[model samples]
Target: MFIGRQHELIALQRMYDSKRFEMMVIYGRRRVGKTALIDHFLDGKTALYFTARQQNSRLILQSFAMAIAAYFNQPEVDFRSWDNAIDYLVSQARRHAGDKLVIVLDEFPYAAEAEPSLPSILQIAIDHGLKDTNTMLILSGSNQGFMESKVLGVHSPLYGRRTGQIKLQPFDCFDAARFVEHCTAEDAVRYYATFGGTPYYLAQLDPQLSYEQNVAMLCFDQAGLLYEEPMMMLREELKSPAIYDSILQAVSNGCNTPKIIADHIGLEPTSVSFYLKTLEELRLIERSIPFGEKPTSRKSRIHIKDPFFAYWYRFVAPNVTLIETGSGVEIARKTAESAVFATYVGQQFETMCMQWIFRAFRSGKLPLMPVLTGKWWGNNPLKREETDIDVVAAEPDEKKILLGECKWRNTVNETEMIASLRDRIGLIRGYRETTLAFFTKNPVHETTLAKYRNDPDMIFVCADDMFRER
Candidate 1:
């Protein structure tokens, strides 16, 4: 069942290929496949795998002793301290026939939190016990904050000790498509919008279920896995989960600007800024500006980085009480009737188009192009309003710009769509070398597609083309 972790497996092989003492730190949000990657890498190797618990130091030490004993087929080796247990492990690793042993400490942050001195202890073992032995030490954790502050931070005793670090991210749209075989391009895009590419969420989806049915089971079922998973996740990560939830809810509900979010949540802008920065650092939320500006000189807005959390805060959290007091099916029916999923999917579709546009530029699709990019508008002169362009390619020095539109509708009228693209090009200010791209739910018009079939300037990229290797 392992899919789409080619890079991580290759990295593990490289570490062993060195044949030196290796210390690796791997961390990411829960359900992002860190454990799965480690398990996949250690499939046939002589490895010791142990998960740390949130408990007292003595209890954790006992559990580690038991894990070590189990790893070596010794069921009853009693060790008083981690020092002794790791000493025995190093000895066992050296005695084994393999050139190197992989030792994985999954959720190492929890263990370090339970025993504040565990990292120093591991450092002791690494320096004195395992440096000469053929062993690779892998430490993994879910708490980005704790991992950074306690183990990886400069102030930590074991700082400057790790040889490598890996942050496991969700798979992109293509890898996710493998989970549901029969979905169309549009269906796959919608599924990614709702569930994201998190492996855990994709695994929960039933291939036989329709999109709406899967959403009902995921967010509205009484005993579903994801019904209250967000609450549990924040409770474990934050000191005050309620405040964190409030901040996320405000951002997810279209309160993006710092001042706007502060006003909506009734918190001072300064305090909200700190929380937003922490959330951004944790990769739970993001701060973005208009696409083409310098990182420092644009209006910043907050967004929930994880799609599942965004969906939960937008729909499920707002209606949790009704879902609890009334029937789950009734609430889900009302939620689906609101067309929220459609809007979310539309945004994801736009994102996919933009990614492909940038990719095409990188591959020399556009001749002498400075960048393939996007622009957001606080005020539009033609519409006399504000909006964002989904994709924008501009050569600022040449005063040239290209505008594009993305449509996730069931069907698109190609003649009308091309006319609209023509109109959009006319609205640009510093305009030159105008071009258009259309990302459609279905294919483009026959004559229109044939017209641009050989043109390099005007392009139509399908969703599958977005992730293709070429």
Candidate 2:
């Protein structure tokens, strides 16, 4: 069943309502629901959809001709060339001058790769006829690099042609919860942490099963759909899956810097940087600098951006041999009960808290709306050690700041947690007002809640609060 993407639907509807020629570019990683969103939006509309495949140009053209013929309710039609096919499409759009006809070229890169001149042909068609017709032309692809460089880049033939673009992203924690509505809030969080927000991955989860059961089946079982999903994706997107796997494994094991990752993988730092850039382009990993630092800060760190990939590399990749030997169930059980897994969940929980803070700020639920929000890590001079804040936000003038600590444990020492957070307030200088937020997996102690009940600067957020729909 379809889930979120309400904003995307609204945007597409707005474009459709315009009743004018529109060129929309939709692109994202595979399984991120770009196709699902497009299908949903075109549910009752008169549209021609053709998904290109990796094949010869002649076969792709034949398939495109078939789709067009079907759209036009013809017995059969053959287009001799890309120019003829595009010209025919424009002619159909011109026939329906006042009606919006959506022509979607899904997996456009596949077709473009098969026929290198397809983009220039479409560019000429758009310039000569399609742009003035009543066609809402949409080009969608899963190859972000191809879509960006070949279709959306400044030097591309189709440059300055698209009226709108949507770089579809994965669902956030809340939208992801919809797939496992029967699961408890905590269990839902765990499921999200494990499977991540990819709709395809989440749909593979059966809500009837517990989080551990789901993980065991989906991740541990050799026959499961996601058992080798990370490897498959890497092989699909990269030239050297083995090298990428090592880099991902290193980053997942806490080797965050280029030099450290290179050392762990036994590669030169310069060589690793090229592979990292490719992964970044594919949206598998990200490079991040601590909040309040410049973009070029040396403190920058690399992280696996997808939770499922991170979880796989950390928990499954290391135990692949055991899993293949039919000992996966035991390992899954131990993983669920291990402190290491809890630590991993806690790290994901911090990210959820950051998402919650951003949503709250946008919805005007925050005490002070800050201009910037992110994780902060640096040296704590007073303590003569390094420290990190789970979440940090600052106002435009840097006079107001919000500091947060996320605790995924069942029980927290409220007094100590508060004191630790309070002590770190000095890390950010020149803050006139400081708001402290404590995010926990479970509710805090009764007395702790009562003590901070009336404290304006103290904000307490639990898992339920984070899951609650605002």
Candidate 3:
């Protein structure tokens, strides 16, 4: 079941329809559906696909030669070097002049790692011959650093040669809900909060089972597919898995600041900053400041960007010993009934509400468009304590802002919550008009609804409304 990515498919189709020389670079993290998108686009098209493996240069050259041979129906052909392989490709492009011929190198980094001179060789070929032919070239990889620095960076040999590029992202909350369409809207949110928007992970869920059953089978059981997924990904991507594991563990324990994380992991603050930067580059962690504050503010906080990783480190990593000792079912039951788990999901729900606001603004369903939107937290000097707003949005002129609160519980005190949100309005200045928004898991009471029904500035969005088609 292919769910979303209509935009990506349209982009690829536009390039293919041009019938001219083109090079598109596609890259993202592993299991992000890059290959799936390519395969779906290539259906019923004339193309030559080769997936590079971690092997010697000679073996990779031989494999490339075989694919070319098979594509052209000349099985007896062989190429001994990268130069010969590239030359043959250029010759074929010239022979099929004006005809669209796509050549995809999936996992191109593995081939480049084996033969360091491959990019320069390809660059020379592109300049000398391939540019005049109707050949569409695609280079895809999973290593974010290598793809950025070695393939797309300013100093790279292939820099300025690519006609297009795409950094594919995970699905948003609305698109991800399609995976379990039969489940309730609330259960769908919980599933998303657990498995996240990764297509590979979401495909493992069974909608027929309850949320607890699915969570236990896929996460807690020793023989489950995702039992050691985080550890395996770390080992594959990082040089020192143990140090990275310790760093992730520290961040998962609410050590959001550099000094606190360094203290938790027993590392120097400077060294910890380096690792945090790398994690940000890999899209595993994110760093942000208050919405209204400057980018260089000292109140910056770090968070785990991937929801599945956050859940794994918080629950599975801490209880691995007991899980492996055949107590996974009991532990899973306890985890489902724990207040900490509810709090964690509530935090995720706040993020989902922010996403819904952005989508609504794009579709013109809101009263005003926002130029800036994010969560806000700071010291309320009047109250002599720290305070935070779940969702904040400012208009282009900064004369109007939207302040919102998200509730992920069974019931809420509508009047009291509204009064508290009204009190925090004074914390922000320079806004002539303030719009109030509330997102809840359930509907508000009749009395509360009647109180605000005549007010145009009050916006009420419930879980069902969020799940509706935009």
Candidate 4:
């Protein structure tokens, strides 16, 4: 079930084998697989794993004690308080002499919120107690703000104490594809664009169903997991869930300007700005001005950073009434009717292909080093100010650009797509060393395949190639 993250796994193993006290902090948005990764890596190891709750420290201590008793086969072990519980945990870790004891505190932010002094206490234990006891401590959470402030920030008591940290992210295109029971990389990209790389979301998908069908079941159905997921997620993470929902809807509808969103939600811009900052910190929303620019740039646009939230707000939440009253088939029909969704997902699909292009180029699977890669939007290539390449890769020094056109269709003729790529490049202002590459969900035309005939610069990649044909 573990796919990709070979690098992270290796790094984690190396840290564990360092023969000293170690601390790892892993945090990310909900369902990004932080806990899963830890669980997967430490499956059979001697580890004390506990999820923090919103209760008082005393209650949390009791829960931890219970877990320890269960794990150690001593149901009657008594711990009077949080401090005692932690002391015992450190003692047990020291007694386990072979390998280091792995202790994971999932949702540590919740515990810190419940007890402000928890971090100081943890720092004491890590510094005075566990330093030479061979313990690997992991603190993971979904509340990025709380985690940063209490544990990872410079002013925090626990800052600079962690040996390793991972901001667990969603699976990239290639990794997500591996979760597909039976689907092509093209299908996986579509899935990733909509549900995002969240393991929980991808795991819920039915491989036998098409993307639309899966959406119908999971989003349109009133009892589905995602039917009210946004609401639940916000309520869990923010104090003002309704206001946050309004702001999120505004962003999803393209009201990226601060004034526009505030006006739409009937809130003051300053107040809305506070919520926006929180969203940005949590990685739920992002402010972007094209790609490279200052954070306060005038053209900056606020957008939902997570694809699933974007898709839900744009498609499912907007049409909630219809979905609530309509049949499943009607919902699916309506979803399919939106061709614009394809264009949206197509752009993301194209980006994923670009990543593979860069990876292949880096690995020498393809010829040439692509120095610059991005989509040219307002800077159109055509004279009529229409038609831009879906993806472009260039070697600025060589004055060479590789033009690519992505087709998510069932079948693609490489020659025709490449021909279109050639035409699209005409609008690029500074074009130098030009190469041709095609990324298609469907197989390329046979004649075009024959024409390339092992050409280095002229290359084609299908959905299968993106996932290493696994």
Candidate 5:
């Protein structure tokens, strides 16, 4: 089940091989495989691993002392204070069996929660003695905000003390597709969109079952594993789950602007922004801007970056009462026939296309390379309506751009689609020459495709291209 995270494992390995003191801050949202990554990295190494829980500080200290006692083959050692325990660790490191004594404090925020001065104690130990010693320290947690503000921020005692950090992101569509086997391209995409790239969620999927059956089993039923996971995660991180729930619901329901989300939640825009920022810091939501827009642009929009959260709020949460009453199978069948589900999958497909295009562009398959790739939308004067562009790549310094539209459906005509693309591209006046591209599940009409086939500045990707990596 340990599928991805080769890059993070390599980073941690280098720190271990450095034979010097190293502090790495690893944090992300829950179920994102933080512990799994650490476990994978520390395999075959006799490192001292300690996991902190939500107990009293005295109990935590007792538990850590027991682990240390087991590690050092001592008979039930005890500690007078946390400082004493850390000094024993430093002493062990000075005479450790290996060149480096790896020490991982997993769920570090929980320890700090139980003991308010835990970070300060660690900081004092590092500053006074273990600065260049071979005690490689890895503090890992799932609380993104707490780890950032209390451990990495400038005002914290541990600030500017870490040698490296890894904000472990979920796998992309390509890596996510690897979890599904013996499925069609469409079914593979369906599984990926439903569970996203989180290894835990994807592992819960049954490859033998149909997509609808799996949805009924995993989401449409009250006993489903994922049915309670979102709420549990929010409660674990946020103090007010009711407010955060409303915010997630509003954003997933298509409320992108801050004022729009505020209006939907019946809160002031300021409060809405504050909650959204908290969600963003937790890596639960993301704010997006146009490809080449300035970083300070106010036109940014909020969206649920996690695909599982999006599917839950959009489909599962609203029908929970119906599901609990034992009509979940019928509801899931109805969901399969609904156009809304298709549209949701279409949006996920758009993200896949944009990502695939970026990779292809970087590998010299495209005519021009781009430094920035994002979604772009703006006013349309010719059609007297708003224009939306699914994928836009910009090389601002080179004055080049690539415009693309992604379609998940089977029917796409070339002439009509290209004409529409022309009108939408005409609305934006920036690059000297903008190439048109299409990424669809099906191929385009050949007559119209032939026109662009000879054009040097065109790129085309279909479903086969997206799934070929598997």
Candidate 6:
């Protein structure tokens, strides 16, 4: 079943119904459901959908020719080249006489990879034939860099030909949780944290199976579906998977700074930066700075953006030899041991809280909207010390700042925590209004709750409220 992507569906359908010549480009990482989304839109329409494979140009052309024949309800037509394939579609569109004919060219970069001149051919088709008719050509690819630089960049022949583009990102925690069946909100959160909102990973989780069983089945055994996923993920988009894996593993294991990652990976900082930039473009990692810091700030740090990668690198990657040697049970047991996984989950829980807070601000559920939300950590000039705030939302023009803290601890001195947050708020100067918010995985302390019970400007969010409402 389709779990999410309502927004993308609506936008695509609106364009489909516009009754104009349109060329849409859709790109994302693999298994993000670009094909599925297109399928959903093409269900009731007269469409020709061809998925290009990792085959030679001749074979790809043959497959597309077969689709063209099937669409026109005629015998298979022999296509000479990619130019012929695209021109055949353009001819069909022109013959349709203003009636809408949707054409989906999935895995377009693969086709281009097989044939270097495919994009130029597409450009010609769009300019002379397809654009003049009521043809809706949707080019979709998993090669993000290729699609962006080769097809969408200004110097490319296909530049300015796309009517619109959809860069489909993975689902967020709340949206991803919808895919699980009969799971409680907390369990769903764990599921999202482990799968990192990828539909391909989430689909493998059985509703009947316990979480431990699913983790064991998917991640522990040598022959498990996700056991070798770390390499599999990088192999698709990168030349050498080992280096990227090492860098990602380093970040997962707390080597966040570029210098630290360089030291761990035995690469120089400049070399590490190139690798980090590639990973960042792939959306596998995050580089965060203080809320309003410029790009050159020394306070920047890298983080593993994908929860599954973090879990894999921290737990599975390091334990690969043991698992490969048929120690599945031992690996699972070791993974379940101690508070390490809990600490990781606590970090992911804070990220989800910030996401929820940003959503609330966007939907007018908050007291004031913010221009951007980020974590703040720098020298506190007023306090003459260093201070780190978990989450901060800034509205510079309005002089309003939202200071937030997340606690995943089972017990806490809530009064002192709030007091510390108040002090941090004082450190943040130039904001006329400041809102201090606290999020916790456990229940809010009764004393702290009673104190802020009457304060609207103060926000106290507990796990129960977040899970129940988000």
Task: Write down the RMSD of candidate 3 (Cα, Å).
Answer: 1.6
Q: Can you give the lDDT of residue 77 in candidate 5?
A: 73
Q: Rate the local accuracy (lDDT) of all candidates.
A: 0.77, 0.90, 0.88, 0.78, 0.84, 0.84
Candidate 2 residues 1-470, lDDT tens each? 99989989998988888867898999999999999999999998888999999999999999999999999998788889998899888788788865688899999999999999999999999998888877888899999999999999999999999999999988888889999887777987888788889999998988678888889999999998899999998888768899999999999989999999999989999999999998888777999888888999999999998889989999999999999999998999999899999999898888788888888888888877768878889999989899999999889575889999999998989899999999899787677999999999998888898988999999999998788672
Model 1 CA RMSD to the hidden true structure, in angstroms: 3.6
- Which regions of candidate 4 fall more than 4 Å away from where they truly are? 71-80, 184-186, 291-297, 358-363, 366-374, 380-389, 392-404, 409-436, 449-455
- Residues 70-125 of candidate 5 have per-residue lDDT tens digits of 88899887798888898888777667755678888999999998888989999988
Per-prediction TM-score: 0.87, 0.97, 0.96, 0.86, 0.95, 0.95
Task: Give model 6 RMSD, 1 decimal.
Answer: 1.8
Candidates ranked by lDDT: 2, 3, 5, 6, 4, 1
Q: Count of backbone clashes for each model?
A: 0, 0, 0, 4, 0, 0
Candidate 1 steric clashes: 0
Candidate with maximal TM-score: 2
Model 1 per-residue lDDT tens digits across residues 1-470: 88888878888889987777888889888888898889888887777788988888888888888888787788777788777777788777668665777788999987888877778888877777677776889999998887887778999877887888898888766677678767766567777777777899899989898877887888887587889988888887878888888899998889988889889989999988888887887677887777556688557667887777887888788777777775677777666656666777777777567656665677787554745466554555676766566677778788767677788776777887777566565455666677777887776767887898997667786666554452
5 against 6, candidate with superior TM-score: 6
Minimum summed lDDT over a 10-residue window in model 3 is located at 72-81
Clashing pairs in 4: 381-427, 399-432, 399-433, 400-433
Among residues 3 or more apart in sequence or in different chains, the pairs in candidate 3 whose N, CA or C atoms overlap within 3 Å are: none
Please state the error at residue 461 of candidate 3 in Å. 1.1
lDDT of 3 by residue, 207-240 (tens): 7888889989989999989889899988888888
